[model samples]
Target: MDHEKVNILLVDDQPAKLLAYEVILKDLGENLVIASSGREALEVLLKTEIAVILVDVCMPELDGFELAAMIREHPRFQKTAMIFISAIQVSDIDRLRGYEMGAVDYVPVPVVPEVLRAKIKVFAELYRKTRELERLNQELEDRVRARTAELENSTAKLRESEQRRSMAIAAGKMGSWDWDWITGDWMWDEGQYRILGVSPESFEVNPANVQALLHPDDVDQLRKAIAEFNSGTRSYETEFRIVRPDGEVRWCVGTAAATVDHSSRVVRVSGVTVDITERKRAEEQQNLLAREVDHRAKNALALAQSIVRLTRADEVKAYVNAVEGRINALARVHTILSLSSWQGAELSKLIDEELAPYSPSGQIRLAGPEVQLLPTTAQTLALALHELFTNSAKYGALSTRSGRLMIGWQVDDELLTLTWEETGGPLVRTPKSRGFGTRSLLASVESQLGGQAKFDWRAEGLLCRLEVPLTRKPAATAPSKFDAAAAAELQRASG
Candidate 1:
């Protein structure tokens, strides 16, 4: 809004262009300084705290490119970016020369007012923001110094006050422990003894004492968090468990942050602790409660969906008909697996089941991870797998016998992934609209199984990838999905 603003520098040899820019930017409230010649611009910058510079390349005595090179020679102005504005069409070679001369960008003559305003506005706003941030950072550093000085002046007095008056308070609140970071010696205030239900006279305060009282299961996590603190890796917030001599276990949470010296070595760390036994108990039961809620909600959804399918059996509306179509589609998946007595059905069996019903020739084939699934899981995978097979048969690579199909499965850790590939088919393109079949496939396989389904339609062929969790209990050719023996059999197979 004022001539003394620091965010922008506007330069143009033509009086008309400079006047036009001033008019356009008048209401912008951004810094604006005009230069009729490159020499005039360089003279203005000798004293101004110029955040940016715009130089016209077609000036009379010295062009924008020459002026930029001169500015680059000055260390103070090395990063003061220059934008070249000129009427003459700049070639690649000319642009390269401009860049070499420290020109940050080039804008042609007869620039659109809106585009110019937007561009300049962005650079001006960024310059002002950068100035504001630098001021804030300086203020923050000053405040931190003042605070640190106060802490240094009062540490001894504060320590004495805590030792005299805080023994009982800490015992009721949390155990008090302090460590000499340099010497690795530790001291536990009398409150520590009460927190652990130990007699102070019988206990020797050391890091080992702290470890001995912690529950074995929580030791590793606490140790890691503390390790990060010691190494100055990050601020410390750690949770642990303590079991007293009376065999009563309680949860505890500790926080610590290291203060570093000038050379960056940690000089000291201090923080507080809180007894969190009740909080930990709630956390332990959270998963069970969540699962119960999810099970009930899912059962309700399935019932509603099933009812809708039955109720809309005779409806002709496209969307209502979609519900009925999904039910029949799921039934088809069941039919294929049922044919095999629910034993691990062949991948080819699934492909043929879905595509054979639509295409004249069942040119389906299978490859990779020749394995069977639990019957329940089978219906889910088969339905999704079938959708891909059907899509290929009609609108994908599987439409022609010349098109090939590749199907495979793999298991690693507890994850099972299936891949489907089709080659020698039609060109790949995105779908215009997703159909009921797509919805059913996604719902049956991914939504129900808590897994992911990915589709990649490459020019070469269509690729489908499905990943699900597999049990470690071994792979089985067992009869029913719900049978424990079946899970055991699969575990054995996996091994």
Candidate 2:
């Protein structure tokens, strides 16, 4: 697309032939350089770049073959297209030699004007494309270099600003202290006494006096750090607890660097101390909450997947009803747990939520101790209770206005056992098939809560019992324990 001028070199020993070659190619509208001999053509080539060369094979001295061979030796002309034109009919051997010497085409003259024009036109277009590509590539490199330099400048300025900020924080918030290695004299900035929770006149500024105020648990570690610094470690840093005169304990981190004399003797030790008890407490709380959230999220997702897998119905509406009911049951338990900061949920509160719908008819009654259930246990039991409630409302005792339901639980040692009883409705009969709700209730009790379940199909009503652990172990934090195979199966099923 670039309309840059391209050169076509024409070489011949005869003036008449050169004139005729010029006349044939002038209509192409490109630069045409003419030379009387091969030597003159080589001289012209040395001064300017050309796209194609048309040379006479029978030129005086420096023949076409010899010139082409010489041109091929130059790195710049390696890809330049060359065509050899001979006045007399050339033999096959001469034509082969011209090709071996880098000739792209050979023509016997009386040359065909159209053939020469087409060949020169192809090379001229190729040269123009090559130049355009080179220009684009150079521009891309320049942009990359400029952007890289800009990033480096930004990074350097950021590092400078960070250094200044760190210096300012150290000066403003920390207590600077120094000790002389030779005289054993101690120095304290006004901030150091405030950090120690003592008036300047009340305490001596000496290593022994300071060590006396350190908590017993931290004294040995602090002493070791000081010993290491005095023995040529060049620096000291350690965190320790100190007890003030009022018996209040505070956590402090101390840092010191040693300066040595030219004679290789320690000269001075200097550094700062700052309180970080609040930061450490905050970090601990954050880690605990993070672990709790991760555990709850994973368990909730697994529960949903299980519910979807276990629920079965012939119609879409039936399946949707079953899944939504179970999810709402889980949400009811979560609402109670969220109120308690996820510590534990009261058994009475959990029962009220699951049985709230049936309580208006006076058919549902709950009696239990003031037991606190862990978050996981509360969720699993809530789902199980909802399934039982649904069955009673449909086919069991609660279907009739006079029917009665009683739930009770008691704790013994490490286990808590619950009993559910029904009466005053149509006679209970053992069903031929166990539905999804029955299986899900049993599975939630046994597998998720690490509990056991039993059912009795008495003629008066249906009776059920469940036993679960009271204190559940906290969830693990490491990701390696997250079962990848189970997650993959869940993903496949969802897909």
Candidate that scores best on lDDT? 2
Could you give candidate 1's per-residue lDDT for residues 184-224 as a string of tens digits? 77666555667677887787767787788889998797679
Q: RMSD of candidate 2 to the true fold?
A: 16.3
**lDDT score of model 1?**
0.68
- Candidate 2: count the clashes: 0
| Residue-level error in angstroms, candidate 1, position 294 | 94
Please give the distance, in angstroms, between residue 457's alpha carbon in candidate 1 and its true position after superposition: 99
List the candidate 1 regions with Cα displacement exceeding 4 Å.
Answer: 1-7, 156-495
Model 1 weakest lDDT span, ten residues long: 474-483
lDDT of each: 0.68, 0.82
**Structural similarity to truth (TM-score) of each candidate:** 0.31, 0.48
Model 2 clash pairs are: none
